[model samples]
Target: MKPHTIKYAFWGAAFGICFPLIATFFELWMSDVSLSIANVIHAHSTQPLLWIIDSAPFILGIVASFAGKKQDKLQELNTHQESIIREKTESLQKRNMILENEIELRKRISVELEAAKIEADSARQAEEKFLANMSHEIRTPLNGIVGFTRLMLDTEIDDQQQEYLQSVMRTSNHLVAIINDILELSKIKAGQIDFEMRPICSNEFFAGVMNTLILAGKDKGLSMNVSLHTSLPEAFIGDTTRLSQVLLNLINNAIKFTSKGSVTLSARMFDADFGTRLRLEVQDTGIGIPADKLESIFNDFQQAESSTTRLYGGTGLGLTISKKIIELLGGKIGVDSTLGEGSVFWVEIPCAACDRPESHAEVIRNQAEPKSLNAKILLAEDNEMNRLLAKSVFEKWTQDVEIDYAFNGKEAIEMLMEKDYDIILMDLQMPEMDGFTATRFIRTEMEAPKRDIPIIALTADVMSVERKKAFAVGMNRYITKPFKPEELISEICLCIERA
Candidate 1:
């Protein structure tokens, strides 16, 4: 079979032959009867016996040689297998090392990323604090400017002086609007805006919005048209104030851009799983936005054209605020425009059908109507000019009502302790003790009438979070500064009546 096997066979045959000769010699040497080697070799008893003995030696030798060869081959195979196993182990160890290094690198990267995020968050918080302080500082002096201007406007004055005062008021209002936009954008970014859901009549809401915006439309020689779908629901539940805000922005934009032709306000409702989906649109025949710029126009501080900012004066935050407000109300807003023809801005809001008639304006109208409260009231304001403005307005609005003033929250608290006032107009940012602390003390520490006395927050901090904080600290109502005289009177009356 194999060369080694053949060699083993040959060796076995030689051994077989040698073993007999050697045995014959040994037998002749040891035996007394066998004197010659020939006689010893021929001394077998039978032919079969001689053949068996001879074959047995050759077969045993062959088998032993084959067994030894097999063991050698098996040892060689085991050695090769061990080498392969060692090589594979070395390869696996190298791969594991690479993997361990990569894992460590990723861990370091993750740690660095987390540190960066923490630093970014810290910087953002610092920026918000700075803005809040700036808003307070700016609005404080602004209240004096707007308040004194209004007071001067009310007094007897020459036509030229009156016109100048009115211009000042308009400029002040513009500045206030810009500040409001910045603050409102900050609120949206901070997720501090909350929507109040209530019943609304689409028709009445549209009418009110049109009434407020028509003068601008008329001034631009543009006709205002309203088209309401007959199938639209009479009453639906949604955030009326936010909806109004969105419509005001759209309509104001329409009026601001249009040189001639008409601005159309329209509404329709569609069936939805939630009950009804209302779509409101403001279409204008104006200098339309370019197709590519439609989406960008809604971004903060963006306009349809760069030149639009120079031509039309605005903070450019209207659409951004409107979009955010619509989104918060569970809606989407979009615009379609032809660059030279016109633009149509639309919003879709999901609403629930309401069985009751819409009465959103009724409560406010009734509460805000000119009326005699004939109740004692205290106005706590730190600014002297704002203080006089409030006094004059309160006196002008209410009949036979005794009003008192306090310079700060501490003074307000002291005045409350001495007298039984029906309500206290609390200003938020005041010296010695802030409105929140004073309100807390009044509610928790004071007794009876003073403790339970209705307190309205009247301050220049118009941020929603600040308003929430004021309410959280026992303020009954909230009103921002540089407000309308009518609004302040309404709040005072409502608070007193509620108490």
Candidate 2:
């Protein structure tokens, strides 16, 4: 104990000691007062001892005073001992309470840690499943690139020439976008993406996305729109590059599913309590998800759980990646819909993006003057007649356009690396390296602007799914097989414009 506390304890003991002494003194004082009041006289003449009779009272007072002092001292000692015991008891109680609180905190922490582990495990499993599905998805397309490019190398075709070559180039570009998405997704997840955060021009971004998909939309006869809320803060800090892709996915989904009416995209600020929040909504007057299927639509590798998989074919990763991107931006995603009526999917995020810079391409450049083929072209095709047919079309389009040969996707990539070409017309289906993989590598590996080289898809049917798929993979345009000169001319013009 500190000296001051011990001193206080001693004082308390002294007070306890003085209790008996004070009581005894009071009794003696009362007796003396009563004697004086009574005026009692002792027989003093009987004996000299009697004359000293008041001595008895004085003696009693002395005895009482000494006895009281002794008793007080003993009581002080007892009180001091009791105080020591009390202090020890309190110290132990406090220690016990502290220990109990610590144990409880530890228990709570343990429970929380276990729950976190379980969640992490589930996430890992989901990632594994997605990765597995994605790899197969990737490899399946690669075969076409390799197979078709190889075929062209061995075959010699000389007919309807140009049409077939267009298929190989178009399909290759589509494959590349798939690979690019895979790479970007990895980089973003690994925190290796050098995201340039800036205040993005919302209007410009919206317009650019629209322009990029315009041709595809036209092919499907779908109307597209972008409406921004006036309340929006004009611009916000964000990675526009990524935001564009997410918006593209949403819009493309709208276009693909909605057969009639239109696909509209809008943005508004969602009033939140603490921080800034904005909602990006994509509404499609297409095939709305059923009440039960709404939740599953965002799941990877799923498409409304129908057997008509081939009817509306897709790898089903777009929504999943979009969700991931939104989450990375610290946002929440949800959809509201009714069967047949329509559906609206929205991604709400905190408004914290930097200012945007001027976009790279204002408007796609199209072929200004259509002329005959004169330059050498690497024609990667599987069908010999298709290869010959594409060459003739290219030669016919421009006297300067030349043609080289690759039967499959792998050979096409090799040919692209070997020499330069004014344009490439890609086929969708082939063995080995597919059109998509080849196109992806060329665009991604090539420097910006040069990556803008025209790649047209030569497919059999120009369905909504096929068109979206072609654009998603970076195809300039998807021109169906047995295409007319007028149709091909328009596509060629658009391609040149984009360039």
Candidate 3:
């Protein structure tokens, strides 16, 4: 019951008691009875009036009990809601703690991954730097050795001396090949090798490769043969140097492994929309490769087996370099082999046929050796042995050839300031000033004739970046160390003539 309902009940009881009293007073008045306070009080003392007053307390008690029960229910509901709220807050705190921990763990992993990446990058850079330094250091000494050996070979000597010098030359050549293989593999991985595409006569190209490698096969008592398809073109435009490198690598590998049977080089051409697709294969009755290992052999520094590296005596980079070179020329290379039989390494490359067939006269001109030169030359070198070797070779190759020497690039600059030489052979690495700076000074700062003088870079650094730097700094030509005297002379003559 509500307070308002209790109030209404009390008012109703008062009204009931008053009504009875009023009714008694009216009856007395009608009966001519005296109307007084005492009389009204006696009139209110009735049964109905007493009953109404008595029920008032009970109604109020009932209303009070109902109100108390509603308040109790509200208190109980508030306590239950508070308990649920506390439980939810605890659960949320626990979830927040877990999420924070996970975020911290992820941050730690990210930091570790970044650190590993940095370490790997540093190691790679260190490796490249080491290879570059080793290449320069090894080639520097090898240049003198090979150069002096060639000079000795040219002189009149007994058969024993000739044999000894030839052996030294061959061994030095092998060393050069190994160094080149290492450098080439690095270049391929770094994506720095540039191909020089030109027209090449198929017949002449094959002949030249065979002429250089036939003696090696003959030494092993293996017959070398070539088979050309009739549909093959006489000439094609491609990277002749890289093509020859691939051919030589395949043929040499075949010859090196084969014991007795023939090593055959076969070629054929298929027509394509762009031009002709040439397929060249080198088949040999060599130690055949395992089926599982054939693909791995084309990877850098990998061979068919560890035993193969020990017996074949190679860096295992030849095939890898060959594959990369072929791919650069837009070709694919593969091998087919059996366990007891032989192996066939094949490559297919697209080539554009030459507009005109290569002439035999052009071949004669290319094969002709450089004639005796009677020109003044400036040789800038830091090493004493290299200086002596170059002077000896120049003297041996020509008569009345005046050659001047400079120990470093600064000295070479001073010499050029004094005298005008026909050609300048500049070395890249030196103590005071490097060759690149000196060449730039000559080209940009010096006077007309001196600045315009033919400058050929002679350095042991054979990286593509070094070569590009040489030309970028105004060097007219570049020659790697351990170079043949004939090639150096030819480069000198060509530079002088062009100038």
Candidate 4:
């Protein structure tokens, strides 16, 4: 019926026929009969055992066919299993390649990001250094201009000359203010501004700020006033200097914009879970901001209109700086205005009521005339104009005060070694050696009293990093350039008294 069955059957039939014939021959030989075809046939017919042996071919063939069919089925199942295993292996290899590629991509992205961060840091550092150098260069000249103008104003000059000098002084002061604003914003960006929470008398603080700015408003023929709510606390903890700065900017802006109107500052307070929340408002009858531009006015170097810059002549950084300062003090600032009538700028800051009030006598003492100092002073400055300005200021303050000069920090140190001076006014940037190095050497290497002598940093660099470095090198006090003569004298008297 099948090829394998037929092949097995044929081989079995040949074996069966051959075996019977051979056995018959063996029997005939044993019986002594003649060996022939006829004899073999007769033997086969007579022997039943021979007939049974001949049927073996059919049984053996059937068993052989069944064995072959079982082997074929086993072979087919093995081939199918091998095909599945091959497909699974190829799929796994493809997935592994994809995973490796993704890992490589991630590593590349990480490296690129790290490189970008390093570049950004380097650029920021460079910008800070450049700004510091510019500040020093600009303030040095401004100091000479302001100091000499003040000295000239004190003398007996005619009205025309006096007016001209006053104008020059005003312009120079405006330049100084601009420089200060830029540096202040830079400090904010660098995260270097520090606020001190001290006890402040709300009434006294407002009075002081108004006193300084009221004259400006009067000169412009504008009415300026302050209205304080009875609910406001007499004493609270806040940073008076920063708050004053913001208020000053707002008031100044109002004065500059209004031609014939009044400016008013008001304050009130409400209770909060943290403490007292103070709401301060500056209302001005000035040219108001457009509705669309009100929100954007607080952005850095932004103005409501481009012509506003041309007419007002400001850098437009005032509102931006004020906003940043208020936010840093945990406050919010906003403005509301019409197109032409007026505007109100408001800020609300969190402050805690203080049990201890500030001393009234301290305020009185600061307002009083600066005390005269009779001491030998050493001033280390490289600029010729700055040296002359300092000498002129000292001559104006007191006759008994004796001042010595050093062109650089090295000369200052050498003079210190040779003479006994009461104090040293150190300039931060100098040739040959800087103030930090000189001060460090004085503090660490020099012996007793010379090292102990009071040192004040009189520098033009306004970067907070430079200020911190000055203190770290053992300087007693720091004052920036373009400073008021009265302020400098006051600082000198205090340092001398403390020493």
lDDT of each: 0.81, 0.66, 0.84, 0.87
Kindly report which residue stretches of model 3 are placed more than 4 angstroms away from their true locations once superposed: 1-121, 196-208, 230-238, 269-278, 327-331, 349-371
Model 3, TM vs. native: 0.74
- Among these predicted structures, which one has the highest lDDT? 4
Return whichever of 1 and 4 wins on TM-score: 1
Q: Arrange candidates, best TM-score first.
A: 1, 4, 3, 2
lDDT of 1 by residue, 1-499 (tens): 5555666667777777776666555555655556564575565442344556567567867885796577567767897999999999999899999899999999999999999989988887776777777887888878778877877788899999999999999898988888888887887887878888877776777888888989889988899988999877777788777888888889999988999999999988888777578899999999999888988988989997788988988978999999998888788999989977999999998877676563444565224434566778888888887777777776666666788988888998899998898888888888888889889999899988779999999888877678889989899888876777667777777777777
Q: For model 3, where is the 10-residue window of minimal lDDT?
A: 361-370
Instruction: Give the lowest summed-lDDT range of ten residues in model 4.
Output: 363-372
By TM-score, the best candidate is: 1
Better of 1 and 3 by TM-score: 1
As for lDDT, the candidate ahead, 2 or 4, is 4
Q: Write the per-residue lDDT of candidate 4 for residues 1-499, one digit (tens) a residue.
A: 5555556566756665676667777878876899888887888888898787666666665666676555555656777888888888888888889889988988998898899888887887887888889989998998899889999999999999999999999899889888888889988987889998899888889888887899989998989999999988888889989999999999899888888789999999898777679999999999999999999999999999999999998989999999999999999999999878889999999977776584664421121332347789999999999999999988877777788999888999999999999999999999998899999999998998999999999999988899999999999999998888888877777787787
* Model 3 lDDT per residue over 1-499, tens place: 4444455555555555564555666755765758877765554454455445545555655565565566666767887899899899999999999999999988999999899989877876686778878999999999999999988888899999999999999889999999999988888877778788877777777888888899899999999998888877887788878888999999999998899898999988898777679999999998899999989999888899999878988889899999998888888999999976899999999877775553544311121333446679998899999999888887777766788999888999999999979999999998898899889999999989888999999999988888999999999999999998878877877787788
